[model samples]
Target: MYINPEQLSSYAAKFINLLIDYSPKLISAFLVLFVGLYAIKFINRIIRKIMEKRNLDPTLTKFLADILLWALRILLFVTFISNLGIETSSFVAILGAMGLAVGLSLQGSLSNFAGGMLIIVFKPFKVGDTIEAQGVIATVLEIQIFVTKMLTGNNQTVFVPNGALSNGTIINYSMQGERRADLTFSVSYDSDIKKAKDILLEVLNKNPKVLQKPAPEVFVKNLSASSVDFAVRPWAKNANYGAVFSETLEDCKTALDQAGISVQPFTLQK
Candidate 1:
């Protein structure tokens, strides 16, 4: 075989020319990537400030800002790649296919994520609120992307899926500044109804935790063959509900006993 020095020289010259032509484009892509990342951070910070000024939910605001920043960065990366002379249409198609496959595989997780978004946006309950949902009564500890953490009355931590929580009935006990404690006391049929009512009202009035505005009420709620039930309802600040309720019941019992009132014994219905 015969080798040609002129042909080898020409091939080297072509390689050098191609590298020279692509150098600026490669550098431009790198510069664009750096600027794009900085821009994304700045945009996210601005969004956070705006949401905070509007008093938006912290969970929702953070989630939205993160999603927006990532989407923008992804677009920027695609543009950067295109500047390097790569066709991005096929790349985008591949990404779309991957996304669809991931979505299908994580249906439940996606549902929970959506539910968490709804929870944050609508705010049926917030952190520190005492709520009952999905058969669990607890104080909300944290609202995460896919689940909510709560502390139960017994001091147990429970993680509830946002999917079921959003769809189920939720009772937010702390939404209102005040809550009512509905307590019942039973008296023997032989006891005086008016006397029992007065005792219960006195107990309620003396309790400092009970709210004075709504005014406590004690009335005969039910009359049975063996006992008469009196309803003792008192309004208290949500934070003081447990203390006020327990104290009222104890005070009512002591007052009734001192006043010679008899409580009815529990009897199974025939």
Candidate 2:
């Protein structure tokens, strides 16, 4: 179809008028968006500083800051759009619907996220703590948003989802600064129980790592067909637990051997 010059001119004027009418709203929207973003950043900075001052958990602090920043930015964008003569109720509805869909699809991730928050809040365990959870005994390396990392005694790294970690039983070994080391030794029935107990006490007392406050204990715990068992319990600083345990066992055996204490050999059952 061929257009007349007059019609073209009229269309151009109307388009120009429409642009002029929307220009102020568009500029205002852009200006507001820019200013709002800057304000959001500033507020987030303040929030981070507050969190730091409160000594909040680092993982949860960063996660919360990111969430707050995104939420505010989304709200600012909706306001900016509304300024451009867009209806915001429908926008909010659409956002809610989209959030529901995303939530359903990311259910496990959301559970993990919630679990992370719980861990941060409740503080069942923290980084560097020796913990046993989910059938794994390890030191907590990091507590992340979705997973927890751990280092086992054998120097193996493990990653467990936060959901299971939060929901399961957790044994925090390091919470107590000192731990009791329980050692058992078997001696032939011919050996004097009193002599064995005294010797074990001597070995425990000589160890500098063992604590004196609780005092060491040595008692005949069990009597078997082959030998009598003595239970030796000593308290030591958690940091020196392994060393104290191994050294005490070795020293006890050496001292007993030197004293001619007879130890029965273990025999396997057929």
lDDT of 2 by residue, 182-251 (tens): 8778899888889989999999999999999789898988888788988888899889888888888789
Our model 1 lands, by Cα RMSD against the true structure, at 4.5
RMSD of each: 4.5, 4.0
Tens-digit lDDT string for candidate 1 (152-184): 999999999999899989999999889998877
Clashing pairs in 1: none
Model 1 TM-score on a 0 to 1 scale: 0.83
lDDT of 2: 0.89
What are the lDDT figures for the candidates, one per model? 0.89, 0.89
RMSD of 2: 4.0
Residue 42, candidate 2: C-alpha displacement in angstroms: 2.7
Instruction: TM-score each candidate.
Output: 0.83, 0.81
Q: Model 1 misses residue 110 by how many Å?
A: 2.4
Off by over 4 Å in 1: 1-26, 265-270
